[model samples]
Target chain A: MIPVCKEIRKEILKISNASGHGHIPTCFSIVEIMYAVYSNMKHYPKNPLWEERDVFLLSKGHAALGHYCTLAKLGYFDIKRVYSFGSFMSDFGCHADRFKVPGIEASTGSLGHGIGLAVGMALAFKLKKTDRRVFVVIGDGESNEGTIWEAVMVATNVGLDNLTIIYDNNMSHGRGLQIRNPAERFRAFSCEVVEVDGHDIDALGPEIAKRGNKVRVVVANTVKGYGCKTFVQDQYAWHRRSPNDSELEMLLRELDEETI
Target chain B: MDLSLHDERIVMILGDVSVYLFKDFNDKYPNRLFNMGICENTLISVVAGLSSQGLVPFVHTIAPFVTERSFEQIKLDMCYNKFGGNIVSCGASFDYAWDGATHHCYTDLAILRLLPGIEVIQPGSYKELDVLLRSQYDNGNTTYFRLSDHPHEIDLPVQFGKGAVIKDIGAEITVMTAGPLLGNVLEACRDLPVNLIYFHTIKPIDRELVARYSRTKILVIHDAFGLYEAICEVPNLRVSYHGLSDEFCGWYGAVHDIRRKLGLDPKSLKEFIKNTIEKTGS
Candidate 1:
């Protein structure tokens, strides 16, 4: 089977060239997180509307470009369709459009929202005695939103072990510098928190496996722009900046030379 | 009616449907309806979650509790997400007539109208409410219907989405009202020389009708804070926002008494229009 993360990132970079879109760094940060969810989960491909499929919410919606590409790479839709991202009458906008996309569980972008929805879903599954799992990814900066913590309290208090939340600790956001402390807070709210290197796919597998029927948090420490050379190590500005031609060339070269 | 159809219903998250609406239903089908408490934020979020799973949920609560209390939830969960469901918000402007300021819900139309791709309806009567309820179910859409605790009783077509003219146009200025104020305007029409225009939906404000029918000035009769305040984009036309000011209403009294004290009596309405015409000389 094709490695989901690598394939998705490649397609994402291709779409970035067409729209010259920003948020490349944010998209890059969550690539593996999206990969981990899509790859391991028992999802309904033929019928995305199937009720029993595991629910995945991209709470840190700026990372949706990664989700779009991941959905494409996983054979959810044709990869060429992503070329129309952020275009006129395009279903694939910067944020995940739940109505148009077959697999996205929620439409998101406004932070601090998805976790609450996920919590509700988890509660529903628990009460109904269903095996459906709910996964939500939140940006480190997105943790600042009060609603996220509100849901965390509700989820933990309700003992919703069916939920797993991934925090993309890329250390950046709209107003800049996401607070680097969700461990103590998430723990205070009674959630099991696991800090790991976000780029390490191997580290992710074990951490996810370790979460046995407990509401868990995977704090993925990743650089904002992880893959390209010039943009790879950069922060803040690269979070949503459209690449210049020179930057694009450098990024392509960096990808071409890399051996994953 | 088949109990399953009513049981297979959805909540109007950003409005107030009484606890009785479900409590009465629960008496018949105990497991059917859910009263999500007063947690407006969680309530709307849960409604959206239910909608995602293809569960038809009818969320009901007061306007301030539903809209202001859980506005972000409504925006992110229901509107921006584009989830097709019904949000029936009762007690539009004067629903809180005596409950005072915090109880009044006049700002819903102004704020909800700003969101893209949301269908808003203010049903002027019981017949209109039935029509709206049917439309939301028949055509799966993200819709909001504003209702009054005491809506006007009008014998009209079941078709919604259009405003109804309640009075003839023999006067200069039009006194536009919704909810309880419709009856108030009609009562005052007995003594005054002003025409009445009843606006059903406030979000997509019928500019053409307002501009056509109202020649001199327009006086909006509401019980809560009027559109000129921070909540809604007040119309730019020659309009006056009449409602309880920024003060909260905790006084326990009849709604009519409260209306009279707030200068919302039919006599006051006539005088307000007369003063406007005299001052403008249009």
Candidate 2:
């Protein structure tokens, strides 16, 4: 799992570097969470739109590089398609487009929309009497949106036990805004809240699998730019900027030396 | 009736604004209906989700809240993602006149028409509304039905993407209008030598019909914004527009008074049409 995370991070960096634009820090923060989901969730890569498949939606859609790389690695499409990240007339835009890309459940880039979309899907699954789970990964800053709380209330009121929300609590947003306590905020909306180390696969895997009769929110605490040497500690500088040549070389060197 | 009887996949979601209007629907299918409490933005996204799962979801609310407040959700989650849902918005233009500018939606058509692949409908009569609702339900696309409370008595069959000729007397001047304002337009052009045309489907706008009237003088009157402007986009047509300007109305009064003030009443429209005919020398 660690090696796969490393490879996904490498692919994300490559795409961002090549495009010269992306939300690298945001993508880096949620790499492990996404990796855990793709590895553990029941999905068919060949038949991306299979009805009985578990769905994953990136609510914080600007961090689309992470999802695109993960879907490519999962054999949903050719890995070479990631090279057309920001090219003109390319399917892979900076944001996730469900119509263009296979394995994308919903097209999300605007914040606070994914949770409500997932709730609707969960309601559909419940109505259809299916056991398919809907997983949504949202950014902490994205949680500041009122639509998220609206979805939270609906999810709780409807008792969507099949729905799970994994919040990437990266602690920093654009313009250096910090979320004080994301788990407590989610718990106020009447959901089973669990805190876990976002980078720890051993801890995250079990937490994500735990489900009960109510909606569950797993707040995964993480850092912005998890693996990069210069960006790991910096709060907001690397949120949208791509690395230059020297910085890319340094990031690659740091990733090589880090023990998995 | 066909929507509730035949199609079991149809689910109605409300934004706490249309419960009284849908009481009979609620009584029949209580389990299928959901009142999502005044959160317009969340209502749109949830409908998109339901649509994604192959169920036809219809959302009802006031015009401005659904179109303007939740504009991003309608654009991204519904239309951009190609999820099919029906947005049934009541209170077209200043129908909620005394409720002030917050409730009055003058630009719902304009904002929704900008999005690609979304069918916008404005039914002028209860008969047109009935046919349009069933047709849009069967068609299954991202459609916006701008509903008005003022139902006019018309005898035209409701067809999607086709303009209905309410009164065609072989005149050289054509007057096109939509929504409940069709009643006022009909009264205004009753004595004038002009053909009356009505449009319920605004987005897949019947461009062919508009072009067919290019040789004649065209006068378009709408209650809401941008339908006339969109029709005028048909190249090289001699068109004159009569509707609300691209400005907010801070005046609060009855619907009739507001219409008179905006020069949208029947008498005002009659004067405008007479002037237009004389100017065009048709």
Candidate 3:
């Protein structure tokens, strides 16, 4: 993992531990995918509200911290607000806040809905003959939702190649069981699947650069926590756990005391 | 009442007979229309997509196919989204009695009414329906208007958005009828002096109207689902509801046979209303 990515995951763990409100395992699973997307965004933090800006919807909305941390790191919002997450009336908390947050495209609390909405945005862009693309990151567990498959079928039927779908296939889900391989499942949905080590930004950067008209699925294989040694291999517990003094010391030491 | 003048932005999603019923509108406004053959889920989703793009969609399909078949799509894509569009579901209230269970939609109202922000309408007559079609297009939100396959001409000066309160208000009892069942209620009311009121709209239910008129006597009659659904709202009102009970409708039959089996016969319905009023008064 890059030094910066490692630093951010520790920060997320700190805030989530303090607030006791984060989908950490899922959030940690998609760090590189988030990094890949926000970096390649044509109209990111500069023009967040630009109608023609490429849209990135976190369809598996539970893993919202990945997107939020990436957005803040990319200078979309202030990093200090991350500590206020999950507080009373705090817009920056758990699920992506569409109304208050600048980068979020839509409010998605329910599973299986974001992909459908993303497909609509993509189709509309296509009809307008625009160069903008829509990227959606979904969870392998969320793939079991019927609406996701419904949307997958529709995207394929309509030949929506411009939309890119990434699956954070960290192998584990809410019930603490690893899911079926996302690459195989997504391939069954007729999407062009790309398997990549989610922690490797080099692989992600090259793959994201190759955009096509058909929907692309990037199956990001990742450990829930890549940077902190305590979480690197422990998928279930490390996904969401408070850092005690020792763990915090280890995490902060890994980041070399960088506040950012 | 002329739909062509105001429905300029209306995107008609066609299914079953809707393609034939609104063929002219579809052809003239091809950009604002689409045909999803036999795929009601996609039909609703497509219209929902169009509405998101700022095109006001008026999705059309037979009631059974649109409501029963693609219920999840309607619940999620349209009602949940609270997108502005018109769901003009035709063949409402067993109007497709000949087509059987796959085509019977007695539970559409019962199901759709559960969705918040959805305004429901069941115009008593064709003239009333035409006015509602125009008003709904202008007034945005998710709306489901029940239309009959059998069209008949009936003249009334009163607009149908507001419930039609019969003038002269003679009898002590008020029979609240909705959709095609209003025709049956009106027919039953002719020989009797019982007063008549029609519920043209269902959601954001005219509670004030229902409360005021429900003082003396109340009897709600309509297609099985529509009537039961409306009655469930005013449970405390001294009202008698007449419709099909919650059960699987087995097979297709003539409209009259279905009505008779469901005890929606004019004679039985009128008698039920009269008896309820008499019992309430005594």
Top DockQ prediction, candidate number = 2
lDDT of each: 0.70, 0.86, 0.70
lDDT of 1 by residue, A116-153 (tens): 78876776676467888888899878887777776777
Task: State in Å the error of residue B259, model 2.
Answer: 1.7
| Candidate 2, B1-282: lDDT as tens digits | 356788888888988986887888888988788888888998999999999898889999988999999999999888888887999998888888989988898888988988988988888888888888777774557899888877778678778889888778878889999878888888999999899888988888899988888888787898787678679769998787788776888888888888899898999999999988887787
Binned by DockQ into CAPRI classes (incorrect, acceptable, medium, high), candidate 1 is acceptable
From the highest DockQ down, the ranking of the candidates is 2, 1, 3
Q: Order of all candidates by TM-score, from best down to worst?
A: 2, 3, 1
Candidate number with the higher lDDT (1 or 3) = 3
lDDT of 2 by residue, A147-257 (tens): 988998988887899999999988765445566777787788889999999998888988888777889999998887887766776646776888777778777777777
* Fnat of model 3, as a fraction: 0.04
TM-score of 3: 0.84
Per-model TM-score versus the true fold: 0.78, 0.95, 0.84
For model 3, state the Cα shift of residue A241 in Å. 5.7
Q: How close to the true structure is residue A237 of candidate 2, measured as C-alpha lDDT?
A: 78
lDDT of 3 by residue, B19-111 (tens): 665667656765545554555665666566556656676768788777777677677667666555777787776777887777777777777
lDDT of 3 by residue, A1-260 (tens): 67667656776877776777777667766887888887786765866887668888888887777677888888888878878787898878677767677787766666767777777666666655678788888877777676677677777766788788887776656454445666787788888889988878999977776786568888887766555555655666765566666766776675454322
Instruction: Give the per-residue Cα lDDT of candidate 3 at A248.
Output: 64
